[model samples]
Target: MVLPAPRYRKPANDLRPALPPAQRSGYTSALASPGPFTEMEKLLAVTAIGPDRAGLVRDLSEVVTRSGCSIHESRMMALGSEFAMLMLVGGNWHAIGKLRERAAELQEATGLTITLRDASARPKVDAVPYLVDVVTLDHEGIVLGLSEFFASRGLEIAEMSTRRYNAPHTGAIMFSVQMTVNVPASVHMASLREEFFAYCDAENLDAVLEPAQR
Candidate 1:
């Protein structure tokens, strides 16, 4: 007797792995399909200095735009006859590579000495922010001394700005500094304040240390 024809069974779809209920719905379209994957955004710290001139910013910005990078933050200033700039640029890996490729051209066109550094995001820190202000007669080693003081205590200086000017009435030249420091949570606030005040007094610096106004 002839055997009955064997039945045809559809093959199982084993291309995709078995996923839990939560991930099953999107498993085919989101994971199985071929699609473009996103690249991690990167950062570059750019610094440039050159003779001050008109349209310098416009020229530099044009270069950045052409390279598909965006300036996240920047500080530009004129020091004497020279212009200096510091910028934090953000872009994808390919965009950053494009910027690097155009660096030489940018430098030649802008007449500026440019430097690019890879700046990765810093890990979050558990600390409190404090602002410190110091003013005193213009003299040497003021910044050095203050830096050493904070360094010795394991403090981080987030930002600082200093300048010199003549007193309004006395016309005496004076130096002033403003800084934001990160104080670790483990440090005793009262003790730190006392020590900071004592150090300021010994250095003849009229100072104030207070919590940073958010």
Candidate 2:
């Protein structure tokens, strides 16, 4: 007797079941259409310093716009008589290249010292955020002391700003500090605060350590 023809079978890896006629057409169309495509962004850290002048921001912004780059985050301030800018810009690779090429022109036209460097996105931190505010008589090593205190505890200072100004009534030169620190989740909040306050007391720094509000 003739042997029966071998039965047809799909390969084990072919797990997807066959679709109906209309469904098959739709599925094929979906596969053919390009889904959402997002271009990978390149980052650049741009810093510029120049004499305080009107239209400085305008000029810098114009260059970025023309280069097809956008400033993602920026800090612009007048430090004494000089204007300083720090920016995190994002764009495509070509856009970033264009921006880099224009840096010299921007420096020459705006009288600013410009610097650019490739930057990566900030990594997420698994820690609690606390705000530290300190006001004391202006003296040497205030920041150094505060930084050392946190550093010893393995805390990270995410952002910090310090300023010196004359007291409104007494005309005394006073220093003020504001900082956002990342405290590890494993740290005991009460103990840390107590130690920080004690240290502040010993150093004559009037300080407030509190949880940062979102």
Candidate 3:
């Protein structure tokens, strides 16, 4: 007896036609398929915090590198006994997926809290840069008072570092603040200086304000 003709089965790939040239999503490399990177159009802001220990940076960085992404910028520091790190990572789609998938693994291995988010391009600010230095007998309200002083003037504090120490000869406690502030170019420098010093005098503190070198 003649056997019935075997039924034909279409291959899986044959069912889906190639993406049309114009209809294809721009995110994909070509009209054919997706890969690690099609356009490299995203930036990821990654933040992590963990107990300070040796090889923490190495471990985190290895994850980024092994996944074929680069750490464009990173800031790592020991805050008290804990370590904090912030990194700006750039990668294509697949690379980003790898980073996300492996984040949990990293957490388990290193015990760090890691977060990832999309980041926009940095905007430019035209405000003039200035350095403000203050030194006085250590006391309460120094930082609050200074912060209020700048806020009143609508100045932006880009960065500030404060320290307390004993005076070299007298052994008296001293506090100092060094801050980088952005002042609008429209402000009159001479008059502003006069006004700032007047406030410092009233606060019983010494201050010096001047342009910051690039």
Candidate 4:
């Protein structure tokens, strides 16, 4: 089964455990503690989701602000009755420490499920870009099939979104997807498109693959 990831994931590199309440309550002497790291900085990516309500943005903003972190980038949207957010926070060691220590408080106070993970740095991706558009009758496994097809060919999906809606004239339910995939330079473009068509044909999917516009 394909399940959504949980909130608050520690990376393999993070070896420390959450501090106990007693340790959390006491700040190791400020005089000895090195404050917000000025020279060394890192990003922590946060994902939050909950029932839609007023002041959602404000509450999340307050959490980040209080933690002494800066919002580097974020996106929030209502998905049906649920509100989802993904944000990148940047700060020095001390600030990130404060964030980790207090994030659970925000989650409890706001009734939102929050998850965090360190985003060390994004490695540059060098590959040819291709855009794929697919439309078909709404049905389960469409996404899984598409993803598996790409994976079989060693393709990397950079961005993808799928939506279900009624057809314009017939009003029949339909699923549509627009995605960007990165093909390694070693792969042949013509043959890849042929393989995509073959898979779509077997799956009764309507699809088009083309070079992505710069």
The models' CA-based lDDT, in order, is: 0.71, 0.73, 0.69, 0.71
Runs in model 2 lying further than 4 Å from the true structure: 1-39
Pairs with steric clashes in candidate 1: none
lDDT, candidate 1, at 25: 26
Model 4, runs deviating above 4 Å: 1-39
Best by TM-score: 2
Candidate 4, residue 76: Cα displacement in angstroms equals: 2.6
Descending-TM-score candidate ranking:
2, 1, 4, 3
Q: Poorest 10 consecutive residues of model 1 by lDDT?
A: 8-17
C-alpha RMSD of candidate 4: 16.0
lDDT of 4 by residue, 41-94 (tens): 878999999999999989888888898998876767789999998887888879
Q: For candidate 1, lDDT tens digit of each residue in 117-185?
A: 998655556666676767787899999999999999999877666777766656777787767777777
- Residue 111, candidate 1: alpha-carbon lDDT: 81
- Clash count, predicted structure 2: 0
Residue by residue across 125-183, what tens digits does model 3's lDDT show? 55566667677778999999989988998887766667776666567677877677776
Largest lDDT belongs to which candidate?
Answer: 2
